[model samples]
Target: MLDQLIENATVVDGTGAPAYAADVGIRDGRIAALVRRAPGAPADRAPDRAPDRAPGDAPRDRARTYVDGTGLVLAPGFVDPHTHYDAQLFWDPYATPSMQHGVTTVAGGNCGFTLAPLHPERPGDADYTRRMMARVEGMSLVALEEGAPWSWHSFGDYLDALEGRTAVNAGFMVGHCALRRYVMGPDAIGGRPGADQLDAMLRLFHEAMEAGAWGLSTTQSGTHADGDGQPVASRHAGPEELLALSRAVGEHQGTQIEAIVAGCLDRFSDDEIDLLVRMSAAAGRPLNWNVLTIDAAVPERVPRQLAPSERARQAGGRVVALTMPILTPMNMSLGTFCALNLIPGWGDVLGLPVPERIARLRDADVRAQLLRRAGSEEAGVFRRLAHFDRYVIGDTYAPANEGLTGRVVRDIAAERGMEPFACLVDICANDDLRTVLWPMPSDNDPASWELRRETWQHEDVLLGGSDAGAHLDRMCGAPYTTRFLGDCLRRRKLVGLEQAVRMLTDDPARLLGLRERGRIAEGWHADLVLFDPERIDAGSAVLVHDLPGDSPRLDSRAEGVVGVWVNGVRTVREDALTGAVPGTVLRSGRDTETVGTR
Candidate 1:
């Protein structure tokens, strides 16, 4: 007898194969059978044509559970390859909104940030690690302090903590920053690791790999900083240290490395491209990087960024770029840390104490210097934030600014007979630094959308970089999986449902070497999503207080994710959670096989 049977589904199958009508049978947590309609049969006959069931006898079938998958598209569950769910998983096992959107598997500890390898002898070590995550990954400090159990110190212990608690399959990579901190202690932040320290980090990396870590992840991006605003440890690592650590990844089977380079947000120098190539070459594995955002304002940017992947490939190393399939709108303010800090001189003023920062913003010379720097190319990708006309005022603190909410900065500036920058600073200062600003996202333009479609078609690019659990208050990326499918099926239609599902499922599974979980084959794990093709979308974003410590984060509800099953147990039904935790902690070498260039 089958555990479950889904009848009348248009099976996309997550293989980039043509869609077909089928009745899928599940038994013992695997796809037991896929009973397809005979060739040239009418589509309407799929539901009534179960091979073993007789006519007019639906209830007599041996299947214990039957799902009327009529008018639904069933495919393998999404695999999110780039996320920062390391902290969130400890508190929310479902990794919500992601799980809600049919993502049955997630790869966490990205961009060189993870909470593990804490120094047992050092008090406040966990606190320091959590604070780093809070700052660098945009997790709420209160949530980290109140929600997570900080008892575990080793990477394996952390994975053990999540074993049975998660509702979605989870995997993690040993983080470069965590490894450095474990080896170098308090000196990890700014001090370059000596030979002995580097060797210790390599040993720790090996142990973490042995303990089921997927691989190693690190960052060379300037944007990452710790709680005290110092560069994260990975930023201080020299090329030699990074290559040595990457070499450790090849020591284990079924592993892949993740990195966030300066090229993620800016142009990569030849030296930087060489470094990525050498790192991947040393690892004998693919080096997947975070966040390849397309910008219409700069038409050449995407090509320029992708050239590194080409160079890496030509140099006999594999590299893949991760691009989000949705626009990335950010809510930022002067009082908080944000993409604005990536501006050349903005952090100096913005990072100050409230009183001093307010005073400096009102200073003529300082304001001029900051604006001049922001308008320059040295501001890199963040220069767009200076275009105040595109910014909408959201929240206000002072009574005088009550009417300013929902107004554009340029409009306010024009009415006040001042420049946009001056007007913005005045409004924030008067509001006691509580004013909110919504900037036009970089990837919202039509040209970028077309470019995204084209990029998805590229061999070296993968659909990912959702950053699902990070940047809690600033942005919501967890819904990207469904939102992208919505775009494919309901809006743009540039990508077929079959290809989109393949990109989200089998493509990532193949790249990461996760075994038996990305397809709907007879023996594969039954991680599946059933969704209405006409109505699959992540709705408009809203602020929600669903986190621990009453902290707020952005979230969205899925419109058409009807059923999500992990290991044959329905974790989500009717777009809601069933509280069933059937997820596995996917371990490299144990649950995965060695992956190489296809």
Candidate 2:
């Protein structure tokens, strides 16, 4: 008897193959057979024999469950190659929004930040780590303080804690920051490790791989900082130390390296590209990186960024760029630290208590300084805050400002005969800092969207970078899966459904080395998604108070996901979680095979 049967579906198969009408059979947590129907056959009627089954065997009626997948697309569940769900897995095992978007597998511990391998002697380290995440990852301090158990101290211990507590297959990469902090203590923040310290770090890295970590993740981006606004530990690493760590990944089977090189925020220098190639050469395995977005304003940006991977491949190394398929929307407010902090000297005041912050906002001298900085290049890449017209009031608490909601700051400022910055300050003050605002997305232009479609077809690029669990309060990256499906199937129609499914499934699966997954082939693990192509998309992000600490974060729900199965168990039906935690914790060599260039 079969465990389940999905009948009458147009199977996209996750192999970039043409659509076919088939009935998929599942049993014992794996795909047992794919029974394709002949032309003009009845939906419920089966052929003489099932594909990949014995010649005499027949499709049986003892199946426990059956799904009528008529007019729906069946493809392998998505594998997210980049995320920061490391801590959230402890609190929300399914990695919500992501799981709801048909993601069956996720890789966390991105940007060189993880929650393990703590130094035994460092007391109060957990709090410091929590604060660092709060600052760098946009995680709420209260949630991190209340949600994570912080029980284990080693990489293996961390994995053990998550053993059976997930509904989506999860894996983590050992973080360079945690490794440095463990071995070098206070010096990890700003100083390079000496030879002895490097050896210790390498040993720990090797230990983590042996304990089932997928690989190593690190960052050298200028934007990342600890809670106190200091550069992260990975930024201090010299090229030698980084190459040694990459070499450790090569020594271990089924492991690759993930790094955020310089120029992630803007453009990469030739030296930076060379360093990335060297790291990949040291690993002798694929090196994947987070976030390559197209700025249509600059027509050459996409080609210039892709050129680095070409250079790396010529050097006997491989580098795959991860690009998101959607225009990310971020909802922000002054009550929280956000893009507003990019205004020069604003961080000092934003970090202060509410009373002091309110006083500082009312000060003319401070306001002038802020306006100058916001308009200057010193504001870094986030200088867009100077365009106050792009900000629209979202929600407010004060009655006096009730009518201002959804109004742009520039219009309000003009009517009041005040500068945009001063006008914004006055409004927030009247509301006691409880007004929420939505900034106009700079990348939401049509040119940018078309460029992303162009970039999607690039040979060295992979679709990923959904920073799901991180940036919880400010951004929701978890919905990129469904959002991209809408782009491919409904909106832009740049790629056909089969190619898009292949990009989301087989592409990342091959990079992560997940064998027998990421496809709808018989004998593969039954991680599948049944969704209507027309209705599939990430719905609008809305604030939800579902976190453990009553902390609010933007979350999106899937529109057309009919059902999702993990290891042949229905974990989601009709876009709702089924409370079935049938996921496996993937280990480096034991559970994964080698991933390479397609």
Candidate 3:
């Protein structure tokens, strides 16, 4: 008997195929049958035999549970290729908001940040790692401290801790920062590893892979800093070290590479491009970077950003770029560390106490120096945030900001007869640097959307980079799957629903070498989503103090997601979690196949 069945639904199948009416059956946590229904057939009518089954094999009554999928679209559950749900999974096993939006599987520990492989000799390492995550990833420190018990000491132990505790299939990449700290201790910050230390690191990497790590993730981006304001351990490694580590990936099965170099946040230099090519070539695995932001204002950047992928391919390697279909909305605060801190010379000023920071903001010379540095070439992608005039005031706690909420800084500045930047500073000053600022992106033009569609169709580009579990308070990227689907169905319509579903499902799954997943076929894992095409969307993000220690985060609920399933068990019904934990812990070479470089 079938475990569950959905009758008379429009099945897209996650293959970029045309939708068809079908009755899909699930049994033993796998897709048992897909009985096709005649057009306009009633839900109660018997269906034709499933393609793979004999006549009369799949009776409608055989299903133990029946779900009416009328007026809904059923597709393979979405796979999030990039996320940081490492810590959040320990507390919120369902990986909330993401699972709510139809994501059944998530790839975590991206950008070289993982929570395990801690050194038993160094007790403070866990604390340091937690603080680094809190600082670099915008995770609430209170939540990190009070949420998961830092008990696991190895990559395998961490995976074991989460094995059956989740409602979605979770996979993790062994992170370089943690590995470096585990092997080199405090000296990992700026010192190069000796021969024995390097060999030990390689051995540990092999151990992690054998223990079910998905791959290796590392970062060399300038923006990533430890809790102490020093560069993360991975940043200090030379190119030779990076290449050596990358080469070790080829020795493991079903493993790939994810990294964030200087080019990820900015433009790639010739040397950076060469290094990326070499890393992928040596590993014989596809390398994917975090994000590739498209802006019609800077049309030239599209080709420049994608150049490495082409170069890598030419060098017998594969490099894919991850881009978001919808612009992720983010709120920034001057009182905390954020993209504002990435501005080359503004960190020292912004890092000061609230009173001191406000005093410096009030100083003309200090403000001039800060603005100059922000506008300089070194500012890179963060330069976009320097346009203080475009910032829309969000939350304000001061009486002076009573009427400023929802107003743009430029308009307010003009009304007050002051410069926009100075006006922004004064507004935050009025709130004692606690004002919430939303910098409206200038690249949401039609041209940019068109370019994004073109990029989505590019062979080397994949639709992802949600960064869901990180940046909890300032941004909510977990709901991007629903939001993008809604946009494709109703709003911009730059891509059709079939292609969009394919992008969100099969594309990333194939990239990560996930086997027998990301599609709705007989014998495949029954990870699925049913949604109302007309109403599906990510609702507005709202602040909620739901994390451990009552820490706040921005969360959004899905609008039209009717049901979500993992391993044939329904985890969400009517846009709400059902408290079912039926997910698998996906491991390398077991849950995945080794994707070739070619």
Candidate 4:
């Protein structure tokens, strides 16, 4: 007899075969038997895709629990391969917004900026390896300040901090920022690590891998800035230091690498590509890097760039797994940083207090001065890509710009007879800096949206980088899976359902070597999500202040996550929390072994 059975459901087995009606049986946290209906003539009126009825089988009694999933879909549980829950784990164990969706497994430590192994007693600790996640990843400094206790100081100690109990299963990549700070002190922050410091960092990497860290990650994207608007640690490191770290990760068995290389696109010459290829050959293991987004500018032309380091794998480089995000909902506040990535010199304005930012924006001299400082050559590129549309209000003293809630910045600028930048400043100052903005894509076109589906189907591309626990205010990539399903799979049918599910589940799981998770098979961990196929939709994103320091973050509730079980415990039953904490801090290459329910 099965421990539990779901009768009359569509089984879109994680493998991209075909979806069919079937009855699935579960026992001991695994799919015990695929109870197929007999051949032809509707044996017992069950679907033909249901496991073929055994010959001369005894009439069995009902399962311990019965789920009449007549119109539901059951596939492998979703695995979020990229997030920054390193600090958020302590306060919200369940990983909240993510686990509430179908995500059963999470991999944190993307972009190389994680909080762990810090030596706060050291002089450079506050500067080099710091907790201004708000600046880099949009994490709240208040949460980092008031919520986290400086308990552990090594990679292993950080793992220990996550051990015994956690909300959902997670694997971590040893952070580059923490490692550099641990080894090099302030020199690394200013520029590159010295030879001796590089060696120390390598040693630390080895220790972290041995301590069950999944891998290592570093970011070279210009977007990842310090609180003072400088590049983070790994961004400035010379190639030699990065090559050394790659070698260290290669030496450790069960390790991978993730790096963000936005500047690489601008700076890479042929020699640089050759060097990247060399690094890959040295690393041996696959590298997962911050990825390819759906670019609207040139459509699918892709700027003639070779990115996602894994693309270099065929040319004898490291397999930098592409961390693809299907959506880019540009979440921005009305401060100087509103769509700052789009607007050059805007992030600096955002870093200021509201009054100061407003003052700077109101000063025409400052604008003209900064524009002159930008110079013609560099300023041209900024103007082309920066769209004045899609800026909305996220917060305010009260709702001041309620009338202009979703209006584009261009419209506001035109109506107010001001430069787009000046209009943005006025909106921020007049509205108490509460306006938020996002890019509203016109439609899922074949070139962009279709490319997203095709890229995920790419055998080398790794489906991850939701930035789930980070990006508090503006973005909510956590719902990337649901959006992918609702838009690409269901709405447009760009990709089949089974293939899409596998991209979210087995792909990342297999990449991380998660043994028993991400599958619905016998003897596997019971991390499951049951949902209605037709009724599924990712609700729109909204802000909530549920964090330790009352930090506001975008969260989306899953529409069709009917049930979710973690390690045989129904952590989420009927789309609500059962509060059964059956998650563990999964080790690299050993992402199994369920932790006890807390």
Candidate 5:
């Protein structure tokens, strides 16, 4: 008898093929059989009209459990290739909100941030790791300190801690920052490692690979900084050092590379382009960067950003770019260290204590300097927030800001007879700089959406970069899969549902070399999602104090997700987790295949 049978559903199959009516059976955590309906048959009649059934097959009534998937779309579970769920999985084993959106598998430890391989003799290394994560990833410091025990010292031990304890299949890459700090200690930042230190790093990288790390993830993005306001460890490494680590990846099976160069947030320089090609070629594996933002207003940005991928291909290597189809809305505050601090010279004034920061903001010279830096060419991606007038006030704490919530800074400034920048500073100052600011993205024009649809079909691009686990308080990108699907179905209609599912599932799975987990073929793992095609979406973001130590985070619930299963165990029902913990801790060479570079 089948363990479970889902009947009368439209199966998209995660292959970009046309959807068809079918009944699927699961047994022993694998797809046991598929009973496909004849062409043009109605889904409700699929079971009775199923064709090509094998002899001695058990009837639908013989299944131990049955799911009525009437009028719903059944597809392979979504795979998120870029996330920071490393610490969240320790306390919230379900990887909440993600599984609620049909994400059955997640790859974490991106952008050179991981939580393992601590220095054997230095106990303070753990504290440094926590603070760094808090600073760069937007994770809550209180949650990081109280969420999980910092007992493990090696990558293997860290992986072991999560084994059999999660509700979603999770894999992680070894981060360059942790690897550097482990070997070079306090000298890990802003210097070339000596010969002996280099050798130690290579050996540690090998050990991590052996212990099931997905691959190597590093960063050279100028924006990343530790709690001490120093550049991240990976930013200090020269190209030779990076290439040496890339060479180490070539020796491992089922390993790839993930990196974030400075060009990831802007246009690529010729040297950065060549360096990416060399790294991919050195590793003999594909290298995928974090994000590729598309805006039709900037017509040259897409081609310029994708030029490196073409260059890498010509050089006998592969480079893929991750792009989000939906614009994830994020909230920022003046009191915290955020992208605002990355605005070139603005960091010096913004990094001061609340009293000093407010005092500086009140100074005319300081405001001019900050404004000038934000509008300059050096701002890069952070320039998007330069339009102080467009920011909508979110939460306010001072009595002087009454009736100002939900108002734009420009309108308020006009009413108060003040410049928009001065008005913004005044509002935040009234709240002691704790006012929440929601800057509206200017790239939501129709042309931009059209360009995004075209770019979604690009050969060198894939759909991901959710950043779900990090930036918990400011943003919640975990629901992009459902949100994009909803837009495609009901709003945008730019991309077909079949193709979108394929982008969210098979594309990233193939790029990451996940083994038999991205499709609904017979004998493949039965990770699946069933949802209403008419109403699926991610709801609005809301702040919730659910993290450890009662820290707050932005969260959203799904609209039409009905059921989700990981490895044949139902983990979510009706947009809520079912407390099932049957997910596998995916490891390189065991749960994946070696996807070659060329």
Candidate 6:
């Protein structure tokens, strides 16, 4: 008997091992036994057929729950290493999109944006945190204006606020933005920290590390901007400040690091790559460069970028470029807050009155500027947003325009003999700036996809970039685990099942230094997911209005994520929450020490 028993599961083991049938026994929030394998057999490994178990080591405690997993595959729950749920956690502790798709762990405090130990008073005391979050996370100012109960600002205090949370386990990283604001104040506005300000900021980073922040994350990219279209605090800092801040990570057990450099479209300039190398050298820790991927529709671009990433890593600069899946759903908008437009100086176009915006779009001069910006590879502007010839899939404000759903704006503009921008603005204004823009890239080509698969298989590249808990409106990358396992591993055979499981499981766990997690050995944390590897498929991306601000998020459901557990407590039962809250704030490296089978 046991507190719980998962019998006959094809255990993927999360160790890059071939799948094999075994019974997983759990009790008191830990893996108690491995249901002994056949005698003279090679431990947990088994051929196509199953292995026999040794004499029963069942506990006197009878199973409180039991499930037959005869036809299902079981693996360690996913550890989503990249996400911006710092703001969302204040409201939705479950971290929806990621957790719903079997993510049992998340890393927040990305891009140096986190709410924490403030020297100031409460919520209103540090409006900067709220404002920065509003700009970076696309969080509605009104929501933070009303929702978050901002009490403290110390890194440890922030953790106290987030501890014992109810969704999946989470880890916190010290953000560069918070550091700048805490010390440099508004001086951080232009990027460079003055001499004294730089020293103070560095000291705070070290203090945060000692207080148990997992690592440091910052962005050097211009894409990260404040509401006024200025670079976020850390984005403008020179290479020296970045390297000093990165050094803080090395002090506390050599913590992990994450960074976002500007320019998603072009390869890093020599100076940028040199900067990354210096930061890595200073920190003496591995760094996860924000992202590394090309437009899936055009396969050549990724190779161009990956070449530099590989060069950096090979140069003893431990850096890994997280690659997004082929279908990085495009969400375009002409709203006042469309963050993408900030790049080409077109951000001004968004905040204008609807009539003014429409007039400008139709202006010959404005159209020329937009055209020039759209055609430049350096801009990385998704042309689909400016090209109004797209059709509306759905809308609430205007019924007459709602029928335009599924029709391309190009076709409509051609029929009416109107310019793309004119048609776009008319529809937008007519619909109260509520139009869903979808960029359906040519289906990920099999040959190209296979090449991408090779990247996932690399010892360095972990499978991720779901961008869950952020970008609520534009993309829904949260449920990518199922697709990686189902479509890429099982369906296409691009990577072996064992290798795929390792990518989603062990690799990230190791990278994040969660010692007791992402492995299925006896006495490890019993965090697990059970599914049908053969039948696993990602559901179609659909818009769902679930955020506190009626902010819609693209949610792609998993077809076969049947059950998930955290610390042996069932969190997702039959693909829905059991209403049980067993998660906690896991400070990496520290978590294994604080809460282990010892």
Q: For candidate 3, lDDT tens digit of each residue in 551-586?
A: 999999999999999999999999878999999899
TM-score of each: 0.95, 0.93, 0.97, 0.86, 0.96, 0.89
Error of 5 at 280 (Å): 0.1
Task: Give per-residue CA lDDT, model 5, range 1-598, as digits (tens).
Answer: 7778887778999999999878888889999988886665554433453344321223454566677777899999999999999999988998878999999999998999999989879999999999999999988888889998888999999999999999999999999999999999989987789999999999999999999999999999988999898999999999999999999998989999999999898788888899899999889899999799888766887898898889888887899999988999888888997778878888888888999999999998888888988988888878888999999999999999998999999999999999899999999999999899999998999999989988988899999999999989888899999999999899988999999999989888999999998998999999999999999999998899999999999889998999999999999999978999999899999998999866
Q: Which residues of candidate 5, in runs, are more than 4 Å off? A: 39-61
RMSD of each: 2.6, 3.3, 2.8, 5.3, 2.7, 4.8
Candidate closer to the true structure by lDDT (higher is better), 2 or 5: 5
Evaluate model 5: give its TM-score.
0.96
List the candidates ranked by lDDT, beginning with the highest.
Answer: 3, 5, 1, 2, 6, 4
Candidates ranked by TM-score, best first? 3, 5, 1, 2, 6, 4
Local lDDT at 222 for model 3? 84
lDDT of 3 at 119: 88
Q: Give the top-scoring candidate (TM-score).
A: 3
Distance from true location, Cα of 597 in model 3, Å? 1.2
RMSD of 2: 3.3
Q: In candidate 2, which residue ranges exceed 4 Å CA deviation?
A: 45-61, 343-349, 352-380
Q: What lDDT does the true structure give each of the candidates? A: 0.85, 0.84, 0.90, 0.67, 0.90, 0.71
**By the lDDT metric, which is better: model 2 or model 4?**
2
- Candidate 4 has its poorest 10 consecutive residues by lDDT at 589-598
457-530: candidate 6 lDDT, tens digit per residue: 56556677777877776677788787777766556677777877788888888877786899888899998999
- lDDT by residue (1-598, candidate 2, tens digit) is 6888888789989989999988888999999988887766666532433433322222554566667777888999999998888888878888898999999999988889998887767866777788889988988788888888888888999999998989999989999999999998878999998889999999998989999999889999877889878999999998999999988898888999899976765567787888888998778888888778677866766776776689888877788899888778776666777877745587788878887888898888888887788877666446655666678888888877979988999899999998877888788888888778778777778788778887888778999888889888678888888888898877888788899999999989988899799999989999999999879998888889988779988899999999999999999998888999999899998879976533
Residue 465 of model 4 has an lDDT of 71
What clash count goes with each model?
0, 0, 0, 22, 0, 15
